[model samples]
Target chain A: EPEVTQTPSHQVTQMGQEVILRCVPISNHLYFYWYRQILGQKVEFLVSFYNNEISEKSEIFDDQFSVERPDGSNFTLKIRSTKLEDSAMYFCASSLRAGEGDTQYFGPGTRLTVL
Target chain B: GQQVMQIPQYQHVQEGEDFTTYCNSSTTLSNIQWYKQRPGGHPVFLIQLVKSGEVKKQKRLTFQFGEAKKNSSLHITATQTTDVGTYFCAAHAGKSTFGDGTTLTVKP
Candidate 1:
């Protein structure tokens, strides 16, 4: 089964530095999403992307966050400046469609640790 | 903002015991999905429920969606040690929102 894959399984960066988390969603999937899990917290949605644009985003996805489909298979999330609170396990997910019942497959996740 | 709440943050069961987790959404959902995550592993899709009062079963596991589409439950019969993991119920309104999840620890 084809699955979503993310690069840099673990990322460590300075508090004020910029960081990019990369994901390669399933080749045929159309909609992509980013979610984060703070240590023991519930998974939180960050943003959704389709057609090279953001469909929706949460308050946590503020000015510091941006997502892009720089290439056909690459979906990248960039944080302009990392904060301590931003440290979490970031997961990239994709589904063949954006319908309510569509099943979204998640990647292994990239653990971001900001110092 | 929509919220999905799951009861019993943790569950411990001996091998061959049964287990169940309940999930309630603050608002009506168009659909609900269940995922399981093992220790240090990613969330894996288990099942999806679309219609109200829908029920689906997989092997020894069963899932149900409430008539109001605001609640759901996952039940496992005679669960084994392999059933050890965290189960999360995610609701879809416009976007998917996940519950806090119930962590199951099965002792063999």
Candidate 2:
């Protein structure tokens, strides 16, 4: 089965530094999403994208966060300035459809660590 | 609130024992999906329930969605070590909102 793939499985950056997390979603999937899971916490939705545009975002997705589909296959999330609280596992997901019942497949996740 | 709450944050069961996790939401949902994440692994989709009072079974696992569409449950029969993981229930509308999840440990 095709799976979402993310680069830099683990990222370590200094506070206030910019960082980009990259992911390549399954070949034919259309709906893409970014989610973060704090250690021992629930998965929180950051943003959802369709047709290379953001569909919705959560409060956690503030000024520092931005997502883009720079190419046909690459989806990226950038944080302008990292903070200690921003350290978490970032997962990229995609589904064939954005309907309520469509299943979203998640990537292995990129663990971001800020010091 | 749009929160999806799960109960008994943790569960421990001996091999061959049964385990179940409950998920509830404050508002009615369009659909519910269950995913399992093993230690250091990503969330893997298990099943999706859409209709009210719908029940679906996958081998030894049974999933049910409430009539009101605000609650759901996952039941595993005769648990095995392979069943050790955190089970999360996510609500589906225009986006995915996941529950805190119930972590299950199966001891042989």
Candidate 3:
């Protein structure tokens, strides 16, 4: 089955540096999302994108965070300045549709570690 | 903000014993989804329940959505070592909100 894939399985950056996490969602899926999980915390939603724009975002997705579909298959999340708290497992997910019952497939996740 | 709470954060079961995890959402959900993530792995979709009081089973695992759409449960019958993982219940109203997940450890 086709699955979402992310690049740089692990990322280590210095605090205050900019970093970009890339994801290639399923080719046909329309809705894309980004989530993060602190070491032992629940998965938290960061933002959702559709129709080439952000549909929704959480408080965690502040000015430092931005997402773009730079290309047909590439979905990238950029953090202007990395903070220690930004160190977490960042996951990308996509679904054919957006609804209550739709299943969202998750990628392997990129572990971000800020020094 | 919505919250999905899962109970018994950790469970240890014998190889042949059964295991269960409960999830409750602060607000009513339109649907609920279950996912399993093995240690050091990504989350894998297991099942989705949409209708009220709906029940679905996949081989050894059974899932249920509460009639009120605010709670759900996942039950595994005769769990094996392969069942060792963290099970998360995600509630969907407009966006997805995942629970803290219940980690299962099965001893052989």
Candidate 4:
């Protein structure tokens, strides 16, 4: 089965530094998503992308956060400046169709640790 | 954004016992999906329930979506130590909103 792949399984960054989390979603999937799971917390949606643009974003996805499909297979999330609270497991997901109904396949996740 | 709440934040069971988790939403949901994340692992899609009152089973696991489309549940029969993980119910309206998952631990 083709699964989403992420780079740098674990990332350690300093506070106020920039970091980019990269993901390679399934080739045929159209909708892409980013979610965060703070330690011992529920998975929270950050943003959704389709047609090479952002469809929706959450409050947590403030100005500091940005996502881009710079290339056909690469989906990247960039944090302008990391905060201590930014530390968490970030997962990238994709589905063949609309995310509302289609099943989403999640990546192994990139654990971001900001100190 | 839509929100869903899950019951029994944590569950611990013996190897042969059963386990269940409930997910409830305040408003009608378009669809619901279940995922399991093992310790230190990421969420893996388990199943998706779209129709009202729909029931689907995968081997020993049973999943149900309420008739009103406002709630869902996942039941495991004869749990084993390998069943240890957190189960999450995601209510997707325009986007997916995951409930606080129920962490399960099965002791052999």
Judge candidate 2 against the unseen true structure and give its global Cα lDDT, from 0 to 1: 0.94
lDDT of 2 by residue, A7-105 (tens): 999999999999999999999999999999999998999999999799989899999999999999999999999999999999999999993789899
DockQ score of each predicted structure, in the order shown: 0.75, 0.82, 0.77, 0.85
Q: Write the per-residue lDDT of candidate 3 for residues A47-78, one digit (tens) a residue.
A: 98999999888889999999999999999999
The worst-scoring run of ten residues by lDDT in candidate 1 chain A lies at A95-104
The residue pairs in collision within model 3 are: none
Worst 10-residue lDDT window, candidate 2 chain B: B91-100
TM-score of each: 0.98, 0.98, 0.98, 0.98
Cα displacement (Å) at residue A15, model 2: 0.3
Q: Which stretches of candidate 2 lie over 4 Å from their true place?
A: none
Models ranked on DockQ? 4, 2, 3, 1
Candidate 4 regions exceeding 4 Å error are none
CA lDDT, every model vs. true structure = 0.93, 0.94, 0.93, 0.94
Candidate 4 lDDT at A49 equals 95
TM-score of every candidate's chain A = 0.98, 0.98, 0.98, 0.99
lDDT of 1 at A3: 87
* Docking quality category of candidate 1 according to DockQ thresholds: medium
Task: Tell me how far the alpha carbon of residue A86 in candidate 4 is from the true structure, in angstroms, after superposition.
Answer: 0.2
RMSD of each: 0.9, 0.8, 0.9, 0.8
Q: Give the CA lDDT, 0 to 100, for residue B39 in model 4.
A: 96
